[model samples]
Structure formats: C-alpha cells, structure tokens
Target chain A: MAYSGFRLIREALTGHKGWKPAWRDPEPQAHYDVVVVGGGGHGLATAHYLAKNFGKTRIAVLEKGWIGGGNVGRNTTIIRSNYLLPGNEPFYELSLQLWEGLEQDLNYNAMVSQRGIMNLFHTDAQRDAFRRRGNSMILHGSDAELLDREGVKREAPFLNFDNARFPIKGALMHRRGGTVRHDAVAWGYARSADRYGVDIIQNCEVTGFKIENGKIRGVETSRGTIGAEKVGVAVAGSSGKVMSYAGLRLPIESHVLQAFVSEGLKPMIPGVITFGAGHFYVSQSDKGGLVFGGDIDGYNTYAQRGNLPVVEDVCEGGMAIMPMIGRTRLLRMWGGIMDMSMDGSPIIDRTPIEGLYFNGGWCYGGFKATPASGLTFAHLLATGGPHATAEALRFDRFEKGLMIDEKGAGAQPNLH
Target chain B: MIIPHPLLGPRDAQEFVYLGDASLLDRPDWQHPEAGSAYYEYLYLRDNPAGVHRELWFHEQGDRSWLVVTRDTTTHEILSAELASQVALSKEPVR
Candidate 1:
C-alpha cells in the first residue's frame, strides 16, 4: 500500500510537481525520450537530427567530458568526399553536399572553406594511381582534376619544381575539398540541439549497459541509471570499451594522430596539399598558421603524447614544398586518439545486439563525414535498415569476405 | 644521367640529361665556384628514346646541393657527375 502510494506521488509529480532526479534532485526531474552516448560531433548531431527530423524531443546526450571533448575536437577538420569505394562513394558525397550548405543549415559560421586539396605525384606509377582515383571521383560526379607539371606549377608556384628530392611533377586536385573550424562545428551542434530541448549531460560517463531479456533497457552511468528503449554509442576513440559491455569486439586500432600548427604568417599555401610519397599534408589556416599532420604513432595507445620524429618528417615535407615557410615557428602540437579500422573506413550500422546501435570506426577521417554520418546512423537506427550507399559497410563484412577495399592494390589501413 | 635540383630539400628534384657517349665525366668534375660544392652522378636512358641519342642529368637533391650530371643518351649510363652550388636547399628552420 505504501509503495503504491509512492508510485502515485511519483507519477503525479513527474513534470507537474517538478519531481527531480537524484542527480538533479531537490531541483526537478529531467526525463528524456532517447539517450545518446558520447557528446562529440556525431552524438550531438544525432540528437539534433532526431529532434528536427522526427520531432523526438526529450533526448539526452551524455558525455564523459565537455562536449566535443573526444576526437571530434582534436581532428584536423578536413572536409571532403573523395572516397572511391562503391558504397562509401555516394554516402560521402552526401556529406560533401551537406558541408556545402552547413553554414545556412546550422545558422552558424563553420568556416566551410573550399580552398581545394591537392595530392602531389612523384612518379609515373603514382600519376597513374591518381588518374584512376580521379576517374573514380568523376564517375561519382565529384570534381577531380588531373594536373600535369605546368598545371601543378600554376597552382603552387612556390613549390620546388626543379628540385628533385620529392619533385613536384603533377597532382590530383579535388576542387570541393577544404576545411572547417572544428570547435565551431561542435559548439554549433550543441547549441542547436540544446535549443531543441535536448539535455547535454557533460561529465556523465556510461559505466555499463542495462540489458534485460536480451534487450537494452537503459544505461548504467556514473550519474545514475537512466531508462531508455534504445541506446546509440557514437564514441569514436573509446568506442571499443563502451561496446565491450555487450560482448562485442570491433576491428579497430586505437592510435594517436597528431597535428601541428606553425606561428601566424602571411597567406602562403593556397590549398591543402599532400605528398603522395611521404606521410605529410599541409594547409594554411585562416589565422595565417600553417596547419599540418602526418602518419599516426603507428602503435596502439590512448595517450595523446606525440613523438617528435613524425613531426620532423612532416615539417621536412612541408619545407620541400614551400621553402618560404622556414620563417614560420611552430605554435602548438596536439594528439587525438583515432579508432583506425583495417581498411581506413567507417562503420555506421546497427549492432547485432538488440536495441543497441553503433556509429564509429571513422579512422582518421571522421571530421569530414560528421553530418552524413549522423544522418545515416539515425536513419539506420530508426528503421533498422541500412542506406543503399552504406550497405557494403556492415559490421559483418569482415567475416563475410565482402570488404570494400578502395585503395585497389593496398586496402589495408597501415598501407594507407 | 640524373642530377639534383637544389633549393628543394634532401629529396626534391633531379634533372635527367641524355647525351651520346658515356665518356663525359672522364675529363674533370666542374665544381660550382659560387657555393663551393662538388658532387654529381651520370646514368643512361635505356628504352623509349624520344630524343636524338643519349642522356645527361643532375641530381640536386643529394647532400644539400644539386649535381650537374651527364649520362649516355641511348644506354642511359652515367657519364659524368659534377656538383652545382647554384641551388641551396634551405638554411631556415622548419617549424
């Protein structure tokens, strides 16, 4: 009789009487329709779309740290849709389209600069490879141009066209690829989602899964247990540990990818350029800082301490391209954990576990696919159906021998 | 032949010059008077001869300076390798 009376009081005071949860108790209860794990760009975008598209209000995005505190905030902020694989090509193209309209869509300035991206070729074989890649992009309606020596020189006249170490021969340029402000993307999504009444729970860690009868009931978090019919894990770097609670092991290698920025200088580098032979890519930030990055730490590590050798190699490549950058000083360096998959692709599909879904394995390219990833992930979660463009990216493809290897000869991530 | 193009880096640019005979380097290595540097390599171009005869080149990316190289145009063999100091890779600090 007392328990029944307490239940009656709880039901009556839920929203009307301002019943509060234990975490925010003494204030008022905060209930949500859906619970999203990981408050990075993907999670935040997911909540935002859920509210906008489906009118699914009362969504809560729980983050162990501040919003965008994971790989989303630490990435290089490259935005491109130069994928060559079958299923991934169209899907990423959609992302590129979304990026084109991002400023107006979010009503925030993401600095979506489409300066362009060039992949320099050093050998005949490398040139042929770019040719094929360009053809692939062209097939998908993407603007990929094959530039010869004169063409390359016209684009980057400062390059050492005569020097022979890593000679500037020709290049493959994706005219649509560029960059964005990584932090602004996160905050914009957070604010937009917050405006939709989605709870942004920072410093709330999900400790375990609440499973009952082979179905997800809620999540056990550091704050407390929250009941929900479905759960989505959008964590990138720490995705493995979170999914492990459901006895699942994904094909992901956690490594720290570091990026560095040089002191502010005049605009020199006209576009983001990459050396095909070496592990180096560079672009001048709008702040006049030359931003660049190279290969990962090449080992499994969650720590963000980056080694110096890679940094040196990347800078060396940069100097080879533009000798004038010698006066620039390195401002700061940072490292972010990347969940690199075997093929350097992402997995955005529902898991075998009922009521649980996952959208991760972005490798080092998550920043570019933020909007499309969230849209597709939510679509798959709501309908239990994968998009035709991402059908080949099922988690079980690893076991089914249906790998969508895009690099043709070298599909392995290490080779990439 | 292959020679380096300075001003780039340790691995930047190389100039491939095709010549008639492989007896070019036998005379004497011509060191650039400006930069006080001397180094070069000579090689031959084997197949697909679009030019008249052999080839001579320079490898400027080696050891920080360019190499004024001469090579056999037909066989693509190195004939003479001379260092050219006209091109300096870079003296500035990389960020």
Candidate 2:
C-alpha cells in the first residue's frame, strides 16, 4: 500500500494550492455550525464524522501547527482493543473494527498490522492477573490467550532461561493487537474529511473562545475570528489551557512520553512484547529498526523532552528479552506530550460550558481510539449525549466518584 | 544438571557455572526478584561459555551476583573457570 502521509504533508509544505482553502469572506463569519480546535487526528476525525453522520458540513478545524504535528504524529502507533476495563474495552474494540475497514472507508491504506501484542508475566501473581485479563477479554467478545511457561518458550525461545535471576514463565497474548502507520492514519482522516467539505485551517491558533450568556458563540483564532454555534476542544496536550481560556478547569495533567528506535537491522521481532513486570515494551518497525517506549516522565511538564534514566531502562529491557539486540545501536529518540486524565481513560463528552464539547484526556491510548473516539464524540456533538460505550468517560464521572479504573490499581498519582 | 526444557539445546555441562541456590537475588532493589530472574535467564544464553560442564553450583547470596563452579555431571571433570570475570563486582572475601 502507498504510505503517502509524508508525501501529502510535503506537498502541503511546498505551498500547494490545495493545502488550505482561500476564505471567500475575509471578514468574520456570522456563524458556522461547528468549529473544532486542533486539526490533529481527533479534530479531523470529529469534523469528518460530524459531516458524515450528522449532516453538519459547515465545520472548521483550526490547527496551530501543520495538521497531525501533535501527538497524532508522535505516538508509537500501536493499535488494539485488548482493554479489560468497562468503558475502554468496547470503545477500543469498535476502533479496532474501524481500523480493519479504514483502508476501504477512507480509500487509503494505513498499513495496519495485526501482528499481535504479548505481555510477559514473571511471577505467579502476575500470571494470575494475566489469566483474569484474558478471561475478561473473552467475556467481552475479544480474543485473548493465556500462555504458560512452555507456551512462552514456544512463542519466544530467545528469552533467557536461567542465570541466577528472574525466570521465564508465561504471557498473555492479544493476537488482534498490532500497529499502524500513525501519520498515515492522520492524513487519511484529513484528506477524507476535506473531501467531505470540512475546512482545515492550518497555522490558526485559537486565542480565546467567544461566549455570551453562558453559551459559546465561536472562537477567535490567530487567523481571524470565526463564528460557530458549537465548538469542540480536540486539542490533546494543549487542552487544559484552551479550556482554561473559556473559564473551565479540567481534571487533566500533561506529561511527556518518550519513544526510542534502534538502528535498522534485519527484522528480529515479529510482534510486540510488553514487559508487564517492568516499565517497557518493544516492537520492530517494518523499516527494520527496533521501536520501543516506557512510562511517562513522572513530572508534570509540557516539554517534549525526557530524562535519560527511562531511555536506558527501556533499552536494558530490550536487551534482557532478546540478547542479540544488545549489539544494535540506538539511532534516535523523541517525546510527545500526553494529556492524562485522573482515571487513565479519555473524556469525550459535552461539558458544563454551553455549546462547548471536549475530547481530551487520551492518556497514551488515543491513537488506537481515534476512529471510535471521533465517531462517538461526533455523536455527542450532534445529539447532546455520549455514544453508548463512551457513557463512562463523561466529565461528571470524576466528581461522582465513578471513574472507570481499568488497571484495577488505584489511579497512579504519578501516572495519568 | 539437566537442560531445562525443549527450547534450550543440549550443550556439554562444561558451558555453565554452578553458583548454588538462588538466594542473593532475593531482594527488592535489584529490581523485583521476578525481574532479576528474567535478567539472569537471559544472561545464561548470551554470556560466553565458561566453567565446568555438568554439575554447576550458583551462589547468589554474597554480592547478589552468581558464582558458578562447573563440573561434569557424569565424570565430575572440573572445568577451567572462575567467578571473577563474569560480573563487574569482586568476589574477594571481606574482613
């Protein structure tokens, strides 16, 4: 399949005529049906779905940078519905289903790979946890396998058997989980949404929201003030500040998550392996480099730079799992800021602010949830109620003490 | 010492070190003991072969690193190896 995400973006950067729409009306518009902030994946998807499902075609997606320049372009690109939580599982499952049909839906190939994701378990307690997680997925109509020690060896024989340390045991495998070309997914949505008549305005930063009598009228942007009946805050990392300008405080924290890639080698790993006991996960990209990541930088900061300890720790994990990789040199690393919610799940709902909608608090799993998130967030925007699966992600759930804590572990104050 | 399972190929006992039972690895800071186990498991395969062949005793208690003395399981042939070179720490006895 043609991975034209970079190609399209390059075309836009070269001052392509079709890069943006010329405003027929130079002055501020009286009102638009909808205005979306942040032309990243979620914003574009929202505009696309809004037009497709709700007949709301008069929409504007204002981006501060080039489209998809945010976390949409910076993620590790893993996609799966292996969640065991209540609200997260079904919504992600819908996303996985959409991902399977994305090529046909958008007429664009995203290079979606269902190569599987395996979570290794070292202790009996961890194994038991995996068993429960597997069972949970099965109960929810998703595929999950609980592999024993011999099964683990069969799946990944390269693992070290004994030295004087942690033993090789079993793993929980989600065969439907895999990766996609992240930038392609974004560009596919942008192009498809543009075809649907959604105006994608680049270099347009939302300076402040225009509200009157407790209802949002539109947004004032760097380009110019645009009027809209409804406004959606789809900005992920910059969400808090955007909503703050509207006099709203959200339960969201911004943190940086780092990902690393090693120099290209012949493909050694065919699937994703997550170190459940340790804070690391790795997979080999089609380009032959070993791609991996770890937990978010514990501190609260928007700077997309991480400390060296996490990088070293994640690399050490790769070497421990596959000894041959110790010889591979790391090429480069980058970080993306994430908007982590208190409950570690996304919040996509109508806020208390009249005519203002939100789709933030994606944590690290937003890439996988793009399709379903857009579909459902649009549903709420048009109908004023959440899509069935997104009911738990409402902003009111936090105050009502009804957080959908899927990890079972209490929300990590340090984590999202 | 029998090779653990189907995944591991049968090599001469001379390739290993017997450091004794896994005791030195029983700490939380060396990373959760489970992590230690996973690390050592990978170490056995990647490290260059040394010590006696058959019967290896691993001693993990002293400095949290393994000390293996390898000997042939059948003939008790002592192999040429020591614990000094495998780890960064010294195995010298402290007064």
Candidate 3:
C-alpha cells in the first residue's frame, strides 16, 4: 500500500494494524528480460530504475544472502559529489541530484540528510589543491565553498586547531554532501521494484551463467536454473568470482575496508569532517553515535574483517583531528570488501560477452553511487549504452590508458 | 595477524606493506609481441580468491625483506610464508 499522511492518520486511529510487509519475497520465475546478480544497494537500485525509468517490467534481482547484506549495509553511509576529476565529478553530481529527490520519488523514508561535508586541509599545498577542486565542482554546477580556519572554528570549535605538526588550515565544504540510511536505500528500492512487478529473490545464489554462442540464455543458481536474456552482475567484491563464470577477468581487486561506530552520546560533531593529512572521515549519526572510517586494510582479501593496525591507524587519525572521540568508547567495528578498481573509479559498461554486463570497481565509494549506478546500469541494459554522465566509466579506458584515476595512485588499488 | 618470516621469527603484521597478488612477480617482458594485453592483465586483473592464496608483503618497518605469504582470504589465516626472492628464483631459469 502507498504510504501517505492520510493513511498514517487512519492507521493510527485503527491501532496501526493496516501496515503490510515492505516488499514481497517472490520465487524465481522461469525467464526474465533482465537479471541482476547481487541484491545489494546497487542491484536493487538497478532493478528499481529498470522498472521506474526504463520501462522494463520483467526483471529479477537474485541475492545470495539478502538485500542490504553486503557493503551496502556496512559502509559509513556518507554521500558526496565533491570530486575533482571531470570524468568522476559530473557522474557523482548527478548522483547527488538523485539523492536530493530520492525520498519523494521512492515514497519511502531513506533518510537522506545533506548536512554537508567539510574536507579539511592542513597545509598550503593542500589548500591550493582544495581550491582547484572547488573550482572544478563549481564548473560542474555543484556547490562548493572554500572556508578559512575561522570558518571551521565557528562551526566545529572542538577540533585540535593548535596541533604542532598538522594544524587546521582550511577546508572545502560541500553543503549538499552528507549521509543516508544505507540499508533503507536497499529496502526502498526493493519495495519500489516489487510494487512494479520486479522479483526480489533472496537466498538465490547465481552459480553460473547460461551462455549459448555469444548471448546469455539465463543463469545457474543454487535454488534452480532461471533464464534471462541479459545479465548484469553488480556483486561488489565478488566481481572477480562472478565474472570468472563468464571466463572474463576484470581490472578489479577485492580488499577489506573497515568502518567504526562509537557508543551513543550527546550530539557532538556538526556534519562530516575528513582529515587532510590522514585517511579518516567522520560524521554523527541520528542516534548520536559518531560514525567514522579510514583507509582500507592494504591487502587483497575477501574476508569481511580487518586487522588491528588499520583500526589503530584510523583511531590515530581520529585523535589527530578531533581529540574528543578518543574519550568516546568505540562500540563496534566491521568490514566490507570493496571492488578496488585499478584507477579507483567505477565501471558501468557492457563486457565483450554479448549479453553479460558488469558494474563494480567502486573502490571505497560505492555507497554514494547507488542511485547513479542503478540508473546508469539500467540505461545501459535497456538502451545498450552508458548514460551520458557515465560514458567514461568503460572497460576499454584501461587499455586506452584513459583510466579515471582520481587519486593518481597509478595501479595501486589499496592506495586508492 | 602475525607473519612468520622465512628469515626472521614471527613478526607483527603492522611492520609490513602489502603489494597484491604474488602473481605480480611474473612481470611480463616489455618487448613481447602482445605486450599490450600482457601488461594489461599483469597490472589490472586479479584472481582475488576467497580461499588460500599467495600475496606479496614488504617488511617495510622490520627486516626490510619481501615475503610471499600464503593466506586464506576467507579467514585471514597465514598458511605459509617464504622469501619472495627464493620463490622468484625457483620459478625462473638461469640467465
């Protein structure tokens, strides 16, 4: 049933017994027009946009575990479009635009809070780089502001501004960037897709693809064989294993990225703040817990857990900027495997295989790209080409040496 | 996790810097006829297995040696560790 204020009031008067399941748990069908592997945020979003935008009704999203069970549910939940490169900035700006209107469009409360994100700069060179990045954002029609030391102090007075080694110099503030309820994004898309006759089959692991000649006929699954004309795999870290089914290797590595949350306390942080000299970013959740994360564990692993060094290093970064968090008890921490692409950008392109498509290599930034990834993948699946904003996220870019290396880290996936 | 170094005793994992799949040791010749695809595969693609695999880790802060550590990606368990140079020498013929 559609959620509305009138419906809420009537349900409240009737003891709120009128609510139903958020989405349907449908069984796999014999055949579908499109099949999306991995029902994480991107896969669900792809199915949602495929139905809502591209007018493809016969779509099925097969999840090995369940929706929101992967990196979608484990990330720090921060979203932003404060990118520097032309190849990446515009696509993320489009994602930010979609996030702005997501709640109204989905008719589900995804809790997209644009409280802003401030990327702190600690040195003169970093300030100049942020200035150039801000100009690029402005040129891309995205809002960006260069704030001085006083501006940061006015908002966040608790920061360690007088530290000897890395004093606060300035920051680039993107007011449209913030956090969303990450798992709710998956649920919202699942429910929206189910309402439009899309099947969301949980526990249905795709074992292999049923390719005949150059085209796909369907997929082999743990449950049973299901048929589809086109298959798109957005299985995040599993990009390696899943694509191997089609006998194709990818320019991707699976590495573990860990995130941390502190025990709930009184509201302390104002918006998201990232360290310039270190690999740390933090924001306060609605429950008053400080949500934060840092660099991925610099190794190749499919394990959804990291070691102590990265944890200690991230805590050190947190202490370097905001010392108050050092006192707050770290309640819990977890890890998720990121599909670290060679150039640290994402790919939403058709593979050499006729009907098989791929979308992954998000590195450490997949959570923010859910909407755009979905819409663009849906566009590619329905129209047989990438969305205009995501044209540069192609497979051939690597061979052509046109890699969209945002960090300039060269073939180092861990550095990106 | 602790890496049992081939030369040294068990050392803390913090002292090492990870480079990726040990397959990187197989650096293709730059002047090969199909260097384009060879370098592309060598540099980008990875078989990031979910089970036991070998990877390169530089002891940047310890003994300053490179070791190929066989690890299970699912459990983060170190299966074996060997000197990287020894492993490379075992693979290559005398020049």
Best by TM-score: 3
Q: Which of the predicted structures, 1 or 2, would earn the higher TM-score when compared with the native?
A: 2
* TM-score of each predicted structure versus truth: 0.74, 0.75, 0.98
lDDT of 3 by residue, A160-272 (tens): 99878889987899999999999899999999999999999999998899989888999999989999989999998889889988888888888899999999989878899
Query: What is the TM-score of chain A, computed separately for every candidate?
Result: 0.89, 0.91, 0.98
After superposing candidate 3 on the true structure, give the runs of residues whose Cα lies further than 4 Å from its correct spot: A410-416, B93-95
lDDT of 2 at A163: 23
Q: lDDT of model 2 at residue B28?
A: 31
How many times do residue backbones clash in model 3? 0
Q: How many backbone clashes does candidate 2 have?
A: 26
Q: RMSD in angstroms, all models?
A: 19.0, 16.9, 1.5
Per-candidate local distance difference test? 0.70, 0.72, 0.90
> Positional deviation of A240 in candidate 1, in angstroms?
1.4
Task: Report per-candidate DockQ.
Answer: 0.01, 0.01, 0.82
What is the model-wide C-alpha lDDT for candidate 1? 0.70
* Candidate 1 Cα deviation (angstroms), residue B11: 28
Ranking by TM-score: 3, 2, 1
How does model 2 score by TM-score? 0.75
